[model samples]
Target: MVNLEGKGGMKREGQRSLLEKAIEIILFVGALSSIIIVFLIIAYMSLEAYPALNLDFLLGWFWDPKKEMFGIFQIIVSTLYVGVGAILITTAIGVPTAIFLAEFCPRNVRNVIKPSIELLVGIPTIVLGFFGLMVVIPFIRDNFGGWGTSVLAGWMILAIMSLPHVISISEDALRAVPNSYKEAALALGATRWQTVKKVLLPYAKTGILASVLLALGRVMGETMAVTMVIGNPRVAWIPTSILDRAKVLTSTILLDWSYVEIPSMHYHSLFGIGLVLFFIVALIDVTATYMVKRGVIK
Candidate 1:
């Protein structure tokens, strides 16, 4: 009886071991698949885009199909400007809104507002684009000028789209902070506002930074919203001001996909822009990761 019982225990242990090994294999395959897929995309883009990767080709700032010429330096710059501008606007608005929600709003108000704001994310980006087109664009044109389809319009649209992500992540970060820290600051007679400024902001900054990076990622790769309102101009520049008409790398492909043909120099150029946009995103992610690893946010 003792021997049989010991054998049963060993059998159960062996089964558990097999299950663990199976899970490990599954996880490894999942991880490897992601890496494989990413590499495949990069490899294909690189092969297709290599032909159009010349400095001269990229300087044209416009594609002339008859001339078979293309230059996207300004388009790249516009993408960067809109991306950065949107980040700035969203951070200003979203972070403060997050602070209000996490720190100031009554529990009841927070409960209602929080979910409502997040529902904005579920709202299709096309809806947001239309909001910019019919409403926001007209408002901007009325107030600021320049045909309304300016970088400012794109910035505003992107900011609206990004708010839910930024506010939610930032509020969660602020809330993740233990209540003890705030209590301690108040106990020491610091103003409620000061406690948040001194203690909460610093401690919660890592999460806030995460929010900014995520929003930047959204702004960087945005297409439809940018396409609808960015006023992708023929004679593009580095976007001297917010009111200037602009073009971004993403809009180039999506906006022109119909005319670009399947497999041509134009298509290759679009692929090159796509590859460039991919790297820009990867770089932001890598930089943020490096900062976190280096304790830059502490």
Candidate 2:
């Protein structure tokens, strides 16, 4: 006996199975393509930069391309210095604001403030750079005394630029914590503050840390804003003080790339600088992912 209904059902199931396999193949291809693209970029940059990369390239302190002085030690140091300073400032301010928004703010007020913070993220970086150039630089020079464009200026601009990322990510982490944990703490006679301190923060620390890492990457890679306000010292030197003029790696590349002959060592060296930055940001991302995965148990 031919069962027409069973045949029809089998046909539908076969069709659905084929569709599922197609979707899986598409996703697999997408993932493979991304990995392949990344490798291609790294390979291209490495080949281009190989001629200029060496111990001297990594450790030399001066960077005058005309004379082929391509030591980027000071530039690397300044990049780290400004990035660390910005991360510190952003983490300090952003984490607390995130906590308040997640745990304490009234709904209406949270609505207003969170959107405003997100909006700040949308403002063009060039506009921020111009603002720092026109206003922040002069204010710093008048009040704090060095060249208006200083490591301090870079820190301030980067910190502002990084704040929205830290706050939004940190707040989501906090909010994602199981509400039952909070309720449980309160039922056990812990105060609200204690619950937040002892329970919420520990649970959310991984997310908060991830946010800071993301901000660090953003600050390190910022070009125009840091370039505008960082003094871009004529002679690259490790900044000894916050008020000292300094030039970071991104600024160096941005300032010099256009002027360098495409086939020259100077041009290759700039790509090397980019390669170094790529490794740094990749390390941060990997570390963040590892820590967050490990932290899931905690």
Candidate 3:
């Protein structure tokens, strides 16, 4: 009987091992497939965009293919402006809110605030655009005096749209600091703010920066929400102020790419913008990572 029981146990163990191996194989294939898809996308965009890609072509602000002007520098600038605006706003509101929630707020209050903030992420971008269009834009136009669809409105929209991500990620980073570290700081006669600023913030630098990077990517890629409020136009020069209608690269693609005849300069030009956008985002990510690493080391 004992031998029979041992045999059954060995059979079950073998089955478990086989199952684990199968799961590992499945996971490996899934990862490999994602990598392949990413490479394929990059290759495809580069191939499509290479024709119109030029150093001089990208330096100007005009995009009329009929006149052979395809300068995207202003569009790039606008995109950067909107992104940086969103980042500044998000960092200001989201980081402080995160700190409050993570360090100061009561558990009951946090439970309410956290979920409410997260719900913003679920709201449709189009709807957010409408809210910007109806409420934020009107308020801006009435109060600040430009056409309601100013960069400030777009910045406000993006900031609101991105809050959940910033707050959630930053709060998690703050929360992840070991209690012992905080306790040590307190024991060393450090104030609460000092402990948080010197110890917790430094310790959780990676996650806070990760949140910023994530928001940066979202702000750069966001279409409906930003486009609706940016008052997009093909500018002849760089925008003089945040109130000047901001035409972003992604909006330019979404608004005009469908009707362009195939095998045309316009079509290829959009692709070129796409390539530039890819490189721009990649560069931002790389720069942010470098900065984070440097800060952590210091």
The models' CA-based lDDT, in order, is 0.84, 0.90, 0.83
What is the Cα-based TM-score of model 2?
0.89
Residue range 120-191, candidate 2, lDDT tens digits: 876688988999999999999999998888988888888888999899989999999999999999999998
Clashing pairs in 2: none
How does candidate 2 score on lDDT?
Answer: 0.90
Identify the candidate with maximal lDDT: 2
Error of 2 at 124 (Å): 2.2
Give the alpha carbon lDDT tens digit for every residue of 1-298 in model 1.
Answer: 1234687878887887899999999999998998899999999999999887888666666555556767877787788889988999999999999999998899999989999987776668898899899998898899988789999999899998999998998898888788999999999999978988999998888888977997798788888888899888755568788888887888878876778777888888878888888998988888767765664435
RMSD of 3: 3.9
lDDT of 1 at 122: 61
Candidate 3 residue-wise lDDT at 173: 81
Candidate 1 wrong stretches, greater than 4 Å:
1-27, 57-66, 290-298
**What TM-score does prediction 1 earn?**
0.86
Candidate 3 residue lDDT tens string, 243-289: 76778888888876756778887788888888888888877778777
Stretches of model 3 off by over 4 angstroms after superposition: 1-28, 286-298
Clashing pairs in 3: none
TM per model? 0.86, 0.89, 0.85
